[model samples]
Target: MKNLHTRRHLLKTMGSGILACGLSGRSWGQSAESGVYGKRAAEVMAHTHENFWLKKRDLYKGAIDKDDPDFIWGGGVMFSAVVAATRHDPKYKSIMRKYFEGMEVYWDTKVKIPGYEPSPTAGGGNDKYYDDNAWMVIMFLEAYEMSGESRYLKRATEVLEFVMSGWDEVGGGGIWWHEKHTGDSKNTCVNAPAAVGCFRLSKFCEPKEAPKYIADGGKIVKWTTKTLRGGNSLFGDAINVVTGQVNGGQLTYNSAMMLRAYTCLYSLTGEDIYLDEAKKMGVAAKAFTDSKTGQYRDSIKWSHLMVEADLELYRWTKEDYLLKRAKTDCDFHYEAWKKEPAKDLITNGGLARQLWLMADMETAAGRDFWKKSDKLRR
Candidate 1:
């Protein structure tokens, strides 16, 4: 009776605390105003915070301990999930701002061109991955769009500038995967999202600045297409700078980012070529979907990006099939997650990402997530 009373008291205080924070009961997945996806998103958000977030550090631990803070890459995905949740429940915006402040631990200040390193500053840091920073730029921009926060936009631009520093004549003009040039290869993972970042920046910059970003983004698209594209218009992993050898291993996210890049270009340039290529790539992405399960073939890290791509495509073409495919895959994944949830950093990040994607599906309402929005203002 004592333990049960304690548990009941804990639940009561938690509910009161949520109410004090201006969140509706539905925001806790208790009611259905936001729909099933929104409810699940709220549940996963709570789970992630309860399991991973460290209030003292203001950042997330990789799992349940203080010893292993999550890497910046996974943290960036988690950041994205927080941003997505804010779209539906504006009460989450405060938590998003707190996370933004906490993420500074990964910002590498030792280098001339500072960017986010893999590890935190206290451990003396590690290699600065362009792909990791590129993901940050994308998510930071999302936060900026939703909150209209100048700080988020400024940080996005700064990180993107660091990523741009990775680009050179290497691998015939593409961004290297990491600052150390470990593999000496330019990857679709980095370049594709970098291109998307550039195109996205074009939207927010001054008219004079917009042209440069678009032109630069176009150059990246041109090089990436000519160099790394493989059979059926799908993108391969990476290309060695010295040997000109292509790593033919394909991941869904590579194609997914490239697909978004193409679509963004189409939106900006209104070019039929970019639109045509985007449609082709969207169709090709189906190859990554499982025939039996209808879910994406890869883990949450890779698959959620494709879900983002499909949703973006659906926004443009009004294609029911595109939306349907994304919804089905996410629905299946959500059910699976309920039975056996992920416990680690990256998988938990992936869990948050899919819930984020589901929240996007719920609140999209014809608004383009990539663009700046006044609608998301609290």
Candidate 2:
């Protein structure tokens, strides 16, 4: 009993020291490859790996207690971050590959239509969420783009098929959030990302098939904008599939995905209207930035995608203020983390999204991967 107690205490100590251990390596002021953002991103990632990663399960637990595995939604977000980190350092490539292998646990093969489930199948649940699978499609495509791995692309395509299965004429053509259709609402969360995923998949498809993806993406974009867009370019949360009543609450990532969709559509079609829409949304999204602190108003998961959309817009518009806003938010958050770590932010999934966003800021500021003049790869 004493030995067991000691082991438990040791594990607790390790979890508690995560932030300190992660931040101990370098001076807060110093910059490294890809500048300060890159350095700090590495630190936070290390903490995530050490404290939350469950090597035995080859998956991340939600928290340091080793209880529940991360929700597949959060896992997908984290996977994208891991893929992004590989751009700054090749060392992350091995970690990214292994993590992707682990993520397959969420893949449900027993169903007539295979898609990623919200929880690990080994734990015996079978329900799938369209939004969760949509996120997987995006993350898998990103992994494929980075590593040129055909398997990643293949998996992304498979998940995208599942996402499309959720689409129906109910309430004028949008993807349902759940496979079981548990909710009456079809969310912007699923539809917008599904559109972005279609645009992304189009790049790798054959000429005959590629246009279909683009057309589908366009249809989704049009439906979502008409159905969800509110004042100030803010998108509402969801719309009831049966009643057609709109859920008026606006969220940052909803607008973020729509902004990315517009940017991607502009890249594909070279339409000034798409660019104009992206700019309008980008301008309106400035409300999410705190006036005094300059920090993002949303939680880390939602706000990171907003910053990513900002960077995508900046790439096209060559707007310096977009970069400045991203830098200010990232810098402030990094310092804030160091000064007084947000205890609530220490979860495996949350840190993963936060790390992904910080690495994107590194890419924006470091300018190592692509330049403002480079064509946006949709």
Give the winner by lDDT. 1
By summed lDDT, the worst window of 10 consecutive residues in model 1 runs over: 21-30
TM-score of each: 0.86, 0.85
Per-residue C-alpha lDDT of model 1 across residues 87-186, encoded as one tens digit per residue: 7777789989998998888887777777998877853455889999999988888788777889998998899999999999965699999888988889
Tell me the spans in candidate 2 whose CA falls farther than 4 Å from its real position: 1-34, 122-126, 340-378
Error of 1 at 101 (Å): 0.8
Candidate 2 lDDT, 155-257, residue by residue in tens: 9898999899999988878899887788688999999999999877877765456756766777788788888888778799999877778997888889989
RMSD of each: 14.6, 14.5
Off by over 4 Å in 1: 1-34, 122-126, 364-378
The CA lDDT of each predicted structure is: 0.76, 0.72
